[model samples]
Target chain A: MEQLVSALLIMIIGVLACAAYFYASNWLLDVLFPSKNKPADIVAKNIHITNTVRPWLFIGPALIALTFYLIYPVIESIRLSFLGRAGEEFVGFDNYAWLFSSDTFYQSFKNNMLWLIVVPTASTFFGLIIATMTDKIWWGNIAKSLIFMPMAISFIGASVIWKFIYDFRSGDDAQIGLLNAIVVFFGGEPQAWITVPFWNNLFLMIILIWIQTGFAMVILSAALRGIPSETIEAAVLDGANSIQIFFKIMVPQIWGTIAVVWTTITILVLKVFDIVLAMTNGQWGTQVLANEMFDWMFRGGGDFGRGAVVAIVIMVLVIPIMVWNIKDVNKEMEGR
Target chain B: MMAVSSSRSSLMWVVHITVFILVVMWTVPTAGLFISSIRDKDQLSVSGWWTALSVSEQRLVARSEHPDKQVFSSDGRYEIRGNILEHQDSSITKFGSSSLRPDEFDVGVVAQLKGGKTLQVLENGDYIYSSPEQWKGKRGKRIFYTANIPPRFTLDNYREVLTSEGLAKSFINSLAVTIPATIIPILMAAFAAYALAWMKFPGRALIIAAVVGLLVVPLQMSLIPLLKTYNLIGEFFGVGSKGYIGIWLAHTGFGLPLAIYLLRNYIAGLPGEIIESARVDGANDFEIFSKIILPLSFPALASFAIFQFLWVWNDLLIAMVFLGNNEEQLVLTGRLRELLGSRGGNWEILTASAFVTIIIPLCVFFGLQRYLVRGLLSGSVK
Candidate 1:
């Protein structure tokens, strides 16, 4: 009861404090830097809206929001990573050392690697196929929309709809779980589909694929449609068959788009939590780093240190990809 | 022939057929959900909805007082003069009324009983009974009638689902989280993106790189740590640790880097001419962004909003972390997830909940979808 009350108290006070801080910062800015540009244009010279100050003003609320929610947590996680389960006592590099020495963490890291490789590739591949095939059809837009419909469903929702598909019921009076019913019809034993470990990950991957294929298709479709018609015609005149044209002309032309599609799916795969939570809850060797963190923190009686280490590791893995993506964008820009 | 002007014109039919097949393939599961939501629960159990339009033979149990009890008499025996044609008045359809004489009747005729009783039945549940004696005994026995019911449709399923299902509350919860989650990120991202795109500063590249670097940092990686941070700060400031504001901030933080990246790319790609001209006209960055860049970059804004809206609306993890699981605070996604375990087989509730969750997204998507143009990149690329 005291905990709940104190938490509430903290929320109200934190908000008020943050507000006060912002106001104080603004005042400090006013006192610290007086503009020397009285001769400036009306738009630029507005004392309240200088180009230098305005951007920060625009950026201020967002920065505070991120700081409390994201940046602070990232810092705190690093601090907590070395702490024990009590969270009061500090243990230096123990969590980091545990990660290198621990088999469980290693296995989880391996599984995540497999998921990252498999999910993005499959989604992107299917997306490319759908995009290319539909691009030629007259009702392409409608077809694309149908495939994209699953994208509207939350990950949890998709997991549910897929659950019925993968459902296994013990041989009951009717074998009502759909997939098991089919297996029964074929005179096979019903299996607990989600408990099947690596195979279950594939099942989870299907849900991601179902939702994301449309995203991949849509972006790639837009890029496909954007290809200059004359370029394709010219390729055809040069004795390229349909397959050759697709491979040589189309693929090369849309490389930037393909890269974008791949990267976006990669980003989504990194944060995948809902499907795992909804379906397997990261049990039976299907645990990814993200869901594992939740297990350690919330489910496993709040192991903040290990959870933080996993988070830091994820950040390390993802930051480089983000940098690579940025570099790719810069290159795409420079190439253009 | 004009048709021969196209060598494979005949194959156009083939192409159309193939495309139609694919469309049907894509549409079947969705169609199944729609049909399952409305179909009678009993019928839904016995057969798939593809048979919804066909007459279904259903065994309807009814009261069958002895036919003699169904009749009324004016005179005693020898009242067989009137057959099933003129007696009681109620219409009965393709199903014969009696189990013993299941096939004893024809299209529109009734039959006479041995005890000078007459019964008439029509195809529409109208029936008449006449007998030489007064009726006696309670409803005789339970009668089974195999009635061929024509296809029936009702809004009752939806009514039951939306009202009693608790989906309505969850739908609102989802929106509460979603609306703020959607708004805060775009608001932040737009400003950050503009700064990154237009504002000159030291370490601009580094800041963007940091943000981009932040992009891959999975929220799961930071989930526990973030919660701890919130708790600590909440402690100092008297805030407990979790709430809507916390979730919104989390969503905004998670959403910010991408929003910044996407919007910056788009804003940066804007014809430099416009920003340059605005600058020359002495317009500051905000005015130029608000007046010139925003309107021109509608496609980007719409796309990003769609992505962010759908994402936050569908988010479960952040909601689980920052927001308490209390009924009032539980978002739609979380609620739907809970329902998946408890009410998994209740197709009506599941479909209705899904539709409720998706309603806003569909609205947002179709609404802004038009702004997703073909060639926003054309001017930028060239």
Candidate 2:
């Protein structure tokens, strides 16, 4: 209770402080250059000066935060990749050599690749299918909401939920988990789904697919709605079947949205950590790059060099997407 | 035409059935978690939550009254009578005197014991033990029974987690981290977004492009370097490296790119006349932004608020890095991860904790789904 009270106090103070900064800074600017009751030329100069400086005042805090937290970190992480464990000595490329030869890094890279290929494609596929199907049904909104419901669940919570489903028991005891029960009912032996070598990565991917499919669905559904009805009518009149109309006309038109969803989920897959950490914890060949980087960061009293190398690996993977995003935004800005 | 119509109707039915199956597949996992959270812990461990509404059978053992309590009856037999269920809401379907054959005799059927004693069990859990003379033993007989237990639900799991497992405290911590983290970014991003959108500034296009580029930079790139920086600052200031203030700033920084981008797009799209006319009325840029743009951009502000709230609330990696794992500062996700490690097999604790962690976000998602969906549509497609 006391902690909660302090937290509330901190929240109120922090917010008030932010409000005070903006208000105080603006007030100071107006006080320093009073445009009213001055010569016309002086007034014009004061207004121009305020206009020039006011924009800086507005953007100052945000710029400091971004540079300190994000931009600086990217640069520092690169420099640290060349240093030693404690970052005291400069060991050139030793961490990179260790990362390249390490079998676990290869395993994590392989698994991350699998995730990159599977999660986005599967999520986009399911999302497009559900969006198209739900658009036709009367109860589609409810179905859409139900499917999207998992998006609210944290990765740890989702891990717990999936872990329960994948639980296993030896001997003749009843199979309490849903998956094992089904397997047992089908006269098959129950297997620990998350412990299997290659198959376990797929099992881990399923959780992400489940959470992200709804995102794909919502975006694609809107894109589908944006498609002109005349195209679909044209296809129907020309004797194209429903599947043909969907694949030929609708899918082709909404291809850009599909790519967007795919890239978004792909970027998310590159940063996947909590799910892997909670379930299997890089054990059983389920290691991914993000989790691997996290393990290196704090493993055995921390190794900043190796950790930065892994982060650089993740950053390298994301460069293409970053460039693509900047180009897309530039185009949009140009159009505007 | 008639054949095509018939086939079209059939296809529609196929779509409905497929969608129905997909919905059930998506919803059942969460529904199962909720059901298991409320189920009796013993039953929850023994049976799947899908069978929560059905009668479950279990092998259980109970002791009869001491033989010394046997007394002479009107039928000329020493007898002992009692209910083996001890007021439990279950019925015995079968019973035996030995562990080897626990369900040896059907309910209401008499089974012969050693020394010419007999025992009869009834479905309602009543048992009668009788002998030709007096039964002799230092302790009561061990009677094993197979019980048919009805479905049971309770709030005990939730109560236990809330009170004992430190979830209540973590819930408060999550709120503390989330509220400030959500609000600070919105304020900072809104100011910057307004400047970029309305106010003419040097290098505005460059800053906008930087924000866009930062949007997809993997957060893994930021963790280690930031940790070192925070440690340095902590040493310099004589404060701990990890705390709510550190985490709130981290979340605000990470969330700012999307917040600025979304808000900038919305604010830029506002009719230019509002700001122009206000400027012509001799209002300063600050007054124009505070009075006109802020009110007009409520929808955009709302969307970003929901996004940041959910992201901060659901984040575990950021919390694990920026905040300490001690009980005083652990947020719900961190707490849930700890519980997963410490009590992996204890579903009672896990389901309840997981539910507690997700309930708030679920409520927020459902309650503000309109803004959430709107935000996603604009953020992604545009």
Candidate 3:
């Protein structure tokens, strides 16, 4: 309780301090210029000076934060990837060599590739299908909300939920887990889902897909709504069936939104960590790049070189999607 | 029209059935967790939550009253009469006097016992034992029964987790981290977004492009370098590297690009006449921003607030890196992950803790769903 009180105090003070900086800086600018009582010539000069200075004032804090947090780190991480474990000695290409030979790294790379292939495609497909289906029903909004609900759950929490479902109990004791119970009811042997090699990665991917499908659905649902009714009506007049209209008239127009959803999920998959950390901590062949990087960070009391390499690996995987996103935004800006 | 109507009905039915199945599949997992969290812990491990409303068959053993409680009837017979479920709350479906055959006798039937004694067990748990001789024993006879127990629910699991598991403290920590992290980014990003949208600057286009590009740079790239920098700065300042302030700044920095991009797009599309009129009225840029633009951009501000709030509240990796794992600073997600490790098999604790961790976000998601969907549509669908 004392901690909670202190936390609230800190929050209030921090917020107030931020507001004060903006307010105080603006006030100081006004005081220094004092355009209220000056002559017309001096007032015009003051206004021009403030206009030039104010834009920087507005953008200065954001710029400082971005450079300090993101830009500097990207450069530093690249440099650190070439350094030794303690970062006191210079090493060239050795960490990459080690990464290539390590079995766990290989497994992580393989599993991440599987995730990259499966999660985005599955999420986007399910999202598009559900969005299209729900748009026609009366309780569409409720159904959409139910399916979208998983987005609010944290990855760790989702892991616990899925882990419970995949729980395996041995012997004649009735299966407590939902999956095992169904398997037992059908006279099949229950398996430990997360411990299975090669296939466990897909089981882990299912959690992410469950959580992200809603994001795709929400975006695509809007895009689906944005399609012009005239196209559908024209298709109808030509005696096009529902499937034909949906595939030919509707999907082709929403391809851009689909690409956006797919790329977004792909980027997210590259940074997947908490689910793996909570579920298996990369044990039993379920290792992914993000969790592997995290393990290297704390393994044997921290190894910055190997960890930075893994981070760079993740960044490399994400660069294509990042480039694609920037180009899409630039195109939109040009159109605007 | 007639043919179209006929086929459309069939299509609609198919849509309804398919959607219903999908909805059930999606909702049942969460519903199972929720139901299991409130259930009797013993019952939870034995049955699925879908059967939570039905009667569950359980094997139980009950001891009858001690032989000392026997009474002498006027007919000179020693008898013992008592309820088999004296303190329990279940109906007996079958009863037996032996362990091997627990359900040997049907309820309300008399069973012949040793030495010509008779025992009767009833559905309501009442039992009678009579013999034509004095009863002398220290303990009563053990009776085995098969019971059809009704569904039971309790708030004890929630209480246990909240009181003993430290989730309540973590809940506050999450709020502390989330509120400032959510608010600071909005303030910083709104100003930058306003400048990018309305002001004339030489490098405005480049800055806008940078913000969009940074939107997808994997956060993994930032963690290592930032950790080193933070350690150095903390050592120089003689303070710990992990604290609420550091995390708030980290989240603000990470969240800024999206916040700025989303808010910039919204602000730039606003009618230019409002700012122009304010300018013509001799108001300066600051005046126009706080007074005119801020009020006009409430919807955008609200939408971004919900997104940032949810993201920060749901984040675990950032918390683990930037904040300490002690009780004073562990956020809900961190606490939950710890619980997953320490209390892995105890679903009673796990379910309740997981439910507590997610309940706030679920509420926020349902409550502000309009703004959330609107934000997603504008932020990505463009």
Candidate 4:
């Protein structure tokens, strides 16, 4: 009975909210985006004052959220990095020295390098190949949907699925792990997959590749579709073969789209944590900068100082790429 | 007659073939998973799901009734009858004791039973006992019969995983995270996007740049710092950091930059003339945004919402960092991860949970699928 009443009340609130939004939106449109008729000077003065206040109402939440969430934490991180757990004892360079001098930090840095180098490139390359192939075809939409399915899956979700594929177990007499099962069927010895230090990283890389390849495919495919048919025809008529036309004409035309996909995946690769966490939990040298930072801050034996340094280092790498991405996007906008 | 067109067409076919292969390669594992998830657990454990169409061979023992249950009749016949399934080798038609001798036994075999009674069994479970005359004892001894049970399909796995496994609860928790996370950003991004898109303001460029800067700063970097800020702020407000609000705010923080970026581009692509005319007609910025910008920018709003919704819904790290690991507070992705580690062998639960997790994202994606394909910047381009 109580549940029924609350349901009723909730519905009433929802209806009321919608009605208010509707009426307010109508009034708002009438005021802010009135018909193109020129207004009187007196009315214009009021409109200008309201307009000044209006943008704040529009953007105010973002500012508040950003200040508290992004900006404040950033400042606090810097400060906390200089302090100990109590956040009172100031140990300025100790955090920096500890992170830099430690083997864990070096390993994390190396993993980050591998991630930065491999994920984006592999993803983009596969995306381009698929894009070029799937530009216009009978089954193109279906094909695209298949590839793009992983993007719908979350990072954690992808990690879980991949774990089964990479499921490793000890002892031959025990249950056959998935990967080992396949290998042994082919008359190969059961390898301790994750225990193989260097190759295990590649095994880890496959998950990211599986996920990002779809994203790259979609964006790059769109770009490929956007390329003008006339340009391709002209290139072919000018004595170019398929490969040459692809490399020369198609590449130049779709560079903008390629840039968009490359940067997007690059940004994603830098923040990667779940795959490593889910698969190996950063054990056996799979830990990257983000996971390491997480380790430093959240775990029981956490170091505030080291966590902050890693955070700052990640920021340093990302900001420049982002700036470049924005500039490219803005330039593309201006060119249009 | 059409050599040039024919060759060109062939080239297109070549491209089509290549694309088709890539798509098939991509979908194989998911298909395998889908097949494995639905099959019987016993079958799933033993063989790859790809073999679901084929019949499976299993072995079991058919045992005769116990010696104590048999009795001699007046006509010199012994009788023993009961559920034969309990017997170790009751009514054996063909019997190979061990898996190493899988092919040794043949059908319609005669084996000598205790007390010199001869029992003949057919390939089927039908057993014939030759006795002297009238049967004595209550019933025949229990015999075990073995048959190749054909492949069985069921929804029981889904039921078990969804109800007993707490998947329904996790599904709800996922929605709780996703809906708010999606809505908050879209609502905020709509306003911010309109302002950046149309409304001229001081420090707009800087904020937009800052947003772009935030985009690149790797969420891993901010996750810790952000958690610290939340704990401190929570202490002041006396609100626990381990609640829905903290994680929502965290997701909101993470989702904002991309939301703002995607949305601003879309809103900016709307007809400037309409906005300008509205401004000239004495309308305020908020009014213009709420009515014109929001409606026209729906497609972009939708696309960005899908992206944000999916990201937050699927998010495990931020949820782990902010939301407590307790079952009630745990997000679907986090719960799924925990389940994967603990019940890695349970394909049914895993797939059903996976399907449930995807339901929202898929709905959001398909609901706004058109926008997903749209490059809102096409307007700016034109």
Q: In candidate 4 chain B, where is summed lDDT lowest over 10 consecutive residues? A: B83-92
Chain B TM-scores of the candidates: 0.74, 0.93, 0.87, 0.81
lDDT of 3 by residue, B1-382 (tens): 8987988898899999999998888877788899999998878887887789998988889888999899998877788999987436789989998998889999999998778888899888998888888888789988899888899999999999998998898899999999999999999999999999999988988899899889988888899898888899999999999999999999999999999999999999999998999999988888999999999999999999999999999999999999998988889999998888888889999999999999999999999999999898888877
What are the TM-scores, per candidate, against the unseen true structure? Answer: 0.77, 0.97, 0.93, 0.84
lDDT of each: 0.68, 0.93, 0.91, 0.70
**Candidate that beats the other on TM-score, 2 or 4, i.e. the better one:** 2
How far in Å is the alpha carbon of B109 misplaced in model 3?
A: 7.0
Model 3 lDDT per residue over A135-223, tens place: 99889999999999999888888888888888888887777788888998898999988899888888889899999999999999999
- Per-residue lDDT for B1-382 in model 4, tens only? 4997899899897887788778776776556656666777766665556567766554555445554656675667765543333323323335433345533546467655555665555654555554554445553443333444456566777788778877777776666666666777677777777888777789887787778767666666566677666778889999787866666667777778778888887777677899889977865565676678878887777777667777788888888888888766667888888887888767667866666666677676656666665632331122
User: lDDT tens string, model 2, A1-336?
Assistant: 788789899999878888899999999999999889999999999999999899999999999889988999999999999999887789999999999999999999999999999999999999999999999999999999999999988999999999999999889989888999999999999988999989999989999999999999999999999999999998888989988999999999999999999999999999999999999999999999999999989999899999999999999999999998998888988987
lDDT minimum window of 10 residues, candidate 2 chain B: B80-89
Off by over 4 Å in 3: A334-336, B1-4, B61-87, B94-144
> Arrange candidates by DockQ, highest first: which order?
2, 3, 4, 1
Question: How big is the positional error of residue B248 in model 2, measured in Å on the Cα after superposition?
Answer: 0.5
- TM-score, candidate number 2: 0.97
lDDT over C-alpha atoms for residue B278 of model 4: 92
Residue-level lDDT for B229 in candidate 2 = 90
Top DockQ: which candidate number?
A: 2
RMSD of each predicted structure: 7.4, 2.0, 3.0, 5.4
Cα lDDT tens digits for candidate 1, B126-230: 445555666565544332334556666556677775567666666666666666667667756776788878887656666766665666666766677666667
